[model samples]
Target chain A: MKNLWFHLMPYKDLPDDFREEHPSVWVDIDSGLLDAERVHQHYHEYLDELEFAGEVGFDGVCCNEHHQNGYGLMPSPNLIAATLTRRTSAPAICVMGNSLALYNPPTRVAEEFAMLDCMSGGRLIAGFPVGTPMDTIFAYGQNPSKLRDRYYEAHDIVMRAWQEPETFAFNGRYNQLRYVNVWPRPVQKPHPPVWIPGGGSVETWRWCAEMDYVYSYLSYFGYKAGAATMQGFWDEMDRLGKDRNPYRAGFLQFVAVGETEKEALELYREPAEYFYGRCLHVNPKWASPAGYQSEATIRAKVQSQVALAAAQSRAGNGQNGGGRPGPMGAARDWEQILDLGYVIAGDPDQVAERIRQVCIDLNVGHLMLLCQFGNMSTELAKYNTRLYAERVLPQIQDLFDDRWEDSWWPQPLEQPATARALA
Target chain B: MRETTISVGGHPVRVLTGGDNPSAPPAVFFAGIGGVPTWVPFLDRLAESRRVIVPSLPGFPGAADFRHLDTLLDWVVHCVETVEALDEAPVDLIGSSAGGALAAEVAAIAGSLVNRLVLIAPFGSHDTEDPGADIWAQVPGPDSIPNLVCERPEAWKHAWQVPEGAEAIDYQVMHTRAMEAAARYLFPFGDTGVVSRLHRVDHPTLLLRGSEDRVLPTSSNERFCAALAGPVRTGELEGAGHLPELDTPDDLAREINAFLADQELG
Candidate 1:
């Protein structure tokens, strides 16, 4: 379907003027209102937004986990997924999930995600991301060098728990549990579709293609910046003799829709600025040396229009004489981010056409849109949501509807008895 | 000293005391359900400085739960009376695990009496979902060995095993037998909400967590810090687990001393 998956980050109580001054990437709203009452308010509003996204004819909705940070107040995305199950009747509840290695037994994820699938009537799209260095190494206390290996181990454990029929013993480098029996088997036969969200790592692209999982580029960078990575992914797919089956590929873009391009740009400019400035702020220490990518791949991302790093640095230096440090300049520059096309603000028809072009260019099956970002107001987001669903969504509705009918992972899961009977 | 082995509402409780100078502040150490007088070494470090008392809890350690007391609330009331019976001018309380739940209840019930409090991985508040099955049992394989070791290897071995003198009532051994019988009484999930009553506790509080502790984890300590009514300070001793005093006595003693010194200064 050409329809976009729209997500709303309901942070309405943020300072009204935050988006005005901060870059769309970095609206550092003060956390003074982070008491229990405000937290509760955000929780309900966030749940409402998830339900609204599903109602708007989005193919799927997304939620992710972040901790001790105001950028995304979703410390527990699974809780949101649970709420989504009861609220929205359709749409996949995506939990760009529990960083595998951070959890003691990766089966905690296996069990919870399976439970989410059952609750959603098999509408779960499990996302296994080898989380960012900051999240993996600093926040979760995982060693940086061994991050991929731990993630692989976690992936294996969760997959085995879903697919293995019997109670088995899994002894891995990280997890060593004696009995492995996850209850409430997933509704999806073998498992729900697996989506690997990558930030342009060659290793990830090749692995996703090899495993036949949908490779979703979480493009916070813009379309032009993401071109190389997208091309690299398609190249990997080609090497595997894979067909351009849209379901195998997905791309996300930050989109804000309004009556006209000028209005859209005006409405989204500050929020977009905040997104580029405060929210994209990364500690230089955490940016880490570029790992697991060819020099050619790195250079390609640098040359792209989406080179956010340069724009960020220029903004960081107070390009508008704001002198406020744009948050993204703490690390790499415009060259690294230029190709990572993250921001896409325009009117409904313009966005719809642009998205269609993006799909055609990248040969991507899914288009994930972030209409609400960097403290964008709920009213503006809802407008974008309505416009996308009413105008843009219909334009590409039939683009891939009949192209792929079979699921990549459709094997039935083994329904094994839990070790402990509920007393 | 009004020393007594009292039978109250069916449970037989033994209380011992020291320091009765009316001007001296009162301190109570609620011992773990390990049955042995393991708190003696730790208490000796505090007794000379404050009016101190330690009570042996009923059940599992072979003492009878006189009224067949099966809940955390019942145990808590029994503890409050035990302190009141001494007639000391209120008491600052310290409790470990199940005892911590009792201490929290005492602070809730007799808020005026509690001057300062310390609770170490108390087991009694049953708010969180019952960790019904032992997580260790659910573990898939033998991979979590690093979680057990602290900086000192001998300390871990010592902490797990019961000492020769009172080997039968070792904390780990008592945990096995008493856990099944005590879990229902231990995980009184309903009791968790009352910790908010800590707001009534008008005294400074200190929370201690072991950095490498996998059993209770650091999240619990964070929750404890959030709930307590008064100002709270939390310290994590690296390379220590559930029994920090047993594993890293120096670090635990240093924290206790520092907290006490700060309290005295305040």
Candidate 2:
């Protein structure tokens, strides 16, 4: 299994009544509640934890872009990935990734991603995401109706800019550029490995399957809530007659680890409550901006609804138990979070056992672990990262070793002539 | 009244036509985001003197679902093609709310097609500062409590035919379709740069408003009156709201006749 560490970088301190007072943590969030010094501290701690993940031998370190959001501080995840290029020799410097629709020229993505590739010695996994409505349509004022169309065009432009040697004119309906040329083409020949992070959108699953890119179910909701979404993706792969290679998918989940379940609960309660209560307290109004979701996606939500209904039924039964209050939709106590599987918090052995079962059941190979979440201290995050790497990672590291080949992983790096000669 | 589908650029656009006499100039009615059905009564009243044509702009229910009309330009082109189909030399154009903005732009784009223009709380222009009360925010969603489209809820309750007790998918689909149509012309607040080219409008225009309407503020409607190039007339219905034609058809008909009669120099 490919273990990756993910970071959300939420502001450490939010008010007790943040849920009641602030209808949303995105779009039109009150700036009065934010302290510059606190965010400055958050950045330092988040970077430290990511670097520690690399040091502790995670297969990849991931970051993603979010705009006008208090929950996620990294609007330019590429900037963070660039910083990680120097800090660690990790296998993949995953900038999971740039919101292509938001960029004006889009060739800018090609240029920066290529730069990161060269700097990391060919260790770059490019993530293409159709941003959330709050980030794309509301905050940026992108015409919701035309956002996906623009996204596809931008993706085409960026890909061509990276691989195509000759300059060409891009006459997209939204973007019209006279000439497109990008310096420092990526080191991975054609381009870096592409991973598409989806949020239960049918179009995304189909697009990912057709493109042969990895479909990542990156929901704040725990694996238990997201199993249906993952199953739908696997089902699509089956319908398309594609191989059910476990590497074809990735899943992100919140997790905490300690010597025992009691200690884990004590360590993670505040952060878990903060995340459920504050980070996910987005206003429903900002969530859907007219045409932000395609008509087909809106219709396909019925299928998701069925899947969700099944999950809820399972939750009601003792079969799929986790947080009592659920991971997403509202704030919950640590016990509720634990009951709902929003976080696999326990001793190293317990975490490994739960994580192993989650992986086997969902048929996922790339496990993106959220070790640093909602106000987790840098020191505690480092400790958890180390524990997961040393104890939990060994228990199930060999489960998918012989199952399927990961076409999505970044290719191994080439050593310099001097280093080879010395060896 | 006869409802039929007309072919424009190989796409079938549904239109409702009533009281036709080829010799007399037709009154082309541009229906709002709700489509052309509710305007049946108002169109019947307008049809008393002369012919009337009401075409559903693409993307709304009862109209072509395909996204052939991709941009606002495509919509203007469709309206132009629609006018050409009528072969009417000088037709009076009347638009309501979202449709009002469409009619105003149609007149601006194809000036010769329109002889005189009347707008009922049209959505195209806005003041950057206050930017009128947001209509999208006010529109009822699948989960939201049904809000009145006009000031007097009972007067036009039937006019805003909001879906009820639909399955999750159907509810979402209905809400999404309406929101999508609104986003096409009025996404960031109905301003489509009509303010800059209002001088291009060769026809006299009437900017009508409902005084008590909160959606499109009266202050912003005043800007619309000032932006026009030709002789402009303005009026407000005291008790009515945004959907004035639906709420007070008699008063709206009186205002329409008086304006058209004066413009005809009769």
Candidate 3:
């Protein structure tokens, strides 16, 4: 099992009545609410927590791209990943990653990712996300109809830029590059391992399986809410006649570990509420742009749990009348958040047990554990990371390693000269 | 009304033709975002005198995928080809909302194919100070119907009603497809550089706006008028919204006919 530490690096100081006052946490988020000095402090604090997770024992540290939003502050996640390469040694620098469609000439992503890979001595997981509708279609002004087309074209360009030994002229519908060649080729032969972080788009599952890439479902809602999506992925794999090599999939879960279940709840309740309440207060308007979802996805979603919950809400029965809370809807209380599996908080043993069950149930080998969430202080983040590293990780890390080889993981130089010189 | 499938730029386009007089130059009607699934009462009124031909712009309901017309240039070329395929050179072109923008573009680039142009609540020019409501931002459903597209939501609801025996989900998908196609040109803001190209449009033009239009700003009317290098006539329809044809179809049809016949405004 591969346990990676992920950080959303959310703006920790949103007002108490942020959800009430603000219409959305993204796209048109009130610029006045953001404090530059605090954001500066947050960068250092969040970077420290990520590095601490690496120092403790996480196999990788992950970050991702979001734009014009308060939810995830890193618009340029590669910049964050670049810093991680210099500061952290043991962990894989996972830029869970650049939104390929947003780059004018997507070769820029290939160039920067290559730089990060070389800097980290090939410890880089190249994440190619189609990006959120809010990020891609709304914030960046990408045409929803053309976003996926541009993304696929960008992906091809990036891959060819890295692997095609000779400089080539590329002509695609969205992009036309006269000369396609990345200056600093990644240290990893044939490029670094590709992981696609998706929001359970049915097409993504088929694409991931066909490409032999890791399909990482980065759900804000934990394993319980994520079960259906992961199951759909494995089912897709089965349909494609591919083997269920657990390493082929990844799942992200928010975990808060402590000495006891009571202590854990007490320690995490505030941050958990903050994350679920304020951070996820996205306006329903910006949630799903037209053309963002393919016809297949839209058809599939008509019967999806979230859509069913939405229908119930529209029928005036209320969303939380029964069953789990919908992923997009706010879960304000700690009890509802826990009940919905938005966050998994308990004693180390209990947390590990739940994680083990999750892995076995979902068949996920790469576990991206979000130890630090909304408004979690740096000290608390470190404590949670260290506690999980000390107890929970040990019990859960060996679950799938014995049976499956993680082909999707990065292959860094065994003993780097830089490391030897530092030692 | 007679319906026929015509190949325009190698894409099958569903065209609706109707009128009493076929000898008069055809008044080619281009529809707004919510396409002409069937002939609305407004088109019926326009067909009373001269021939009316309405072709579903690609990616809208009754049309092929919008992907075929990727850029604004592609759309303009497709429109030109569509007009040419009708075998009516120098036709009277009438467009509503999004289609209005397309009509203006078509008239600008291919003036020889257009005798006169009518743009009703067009979306080509954008005013920063009074930029129209962001149509793409509105959530697709009943709640957003009024704010984004119409003044009278209840009346306009029938415009997008799910056809008899059609599944509601399928209707929703169709609606999404149409909106996606419109957003290709109008996303973020509705400005598509047609304002600059309006200079090439030397044909007689008529611009109409809904007095209560919530989508296109009032300032946009002036922008469209100022940029057109032609004799321009402008009118406002009361008790109407962005889609005047749906709001006050009779009034809209009268205005269109008067402008097309070169009658003085009352």
Give the DockQ (C-alpha) for candidate 1. 0.01
Question: For each predicted model, how many residue pairs clash, with residues at least 3 apart or on different chains?
Answer: 61, 8, 0
Q: Candidate 2 lDDT, tens digit per residue, A70-178? A: 8899989998998888777754888888889999888899889999998888889999988887788878888787888889999999999987889899998778988
User: Any runs in candidate 1 off by more than 4 Å, and if so which?
Assistant: A2-36, A289-341, A406-423, B1-266
Q: What's the candidate order when arranged by decreasing TM-score? A: 3, 2, 1
lDDT of 2: 0.78
Candidate 3: residue pairs that collide: none
**CA error at residue B157 for candidate 2, angstroms:** 6.4
Span of ten consecutive residues with least summed lDDT in model 2 chain A = A319-328
State the TM-score for model 2: 0.91
Candidate 1 chain A: 10-residue stretch with minimal lDDT: A318-327
Query: Better model by TM-score, 2 or 3?
Result: 3
lDDT of 1 by residue, A241-279 (tens): 987787787777777778887887678766665555555
User: What's the TM-score of each model vs. the native?
Assistant: 0.53, 0.91, 0.96
Candidate 3 per-residue lDDT over residues B1-266, each given as its tens digit:
99999998778899999997868668999998667567788888898877999988888878846786678888888888999998887899999988999999999888899988899989888877898787777764555855567777765677677779988787777778888888887776878989999999888888999999998888998899999998899999998999998888999999888888874422
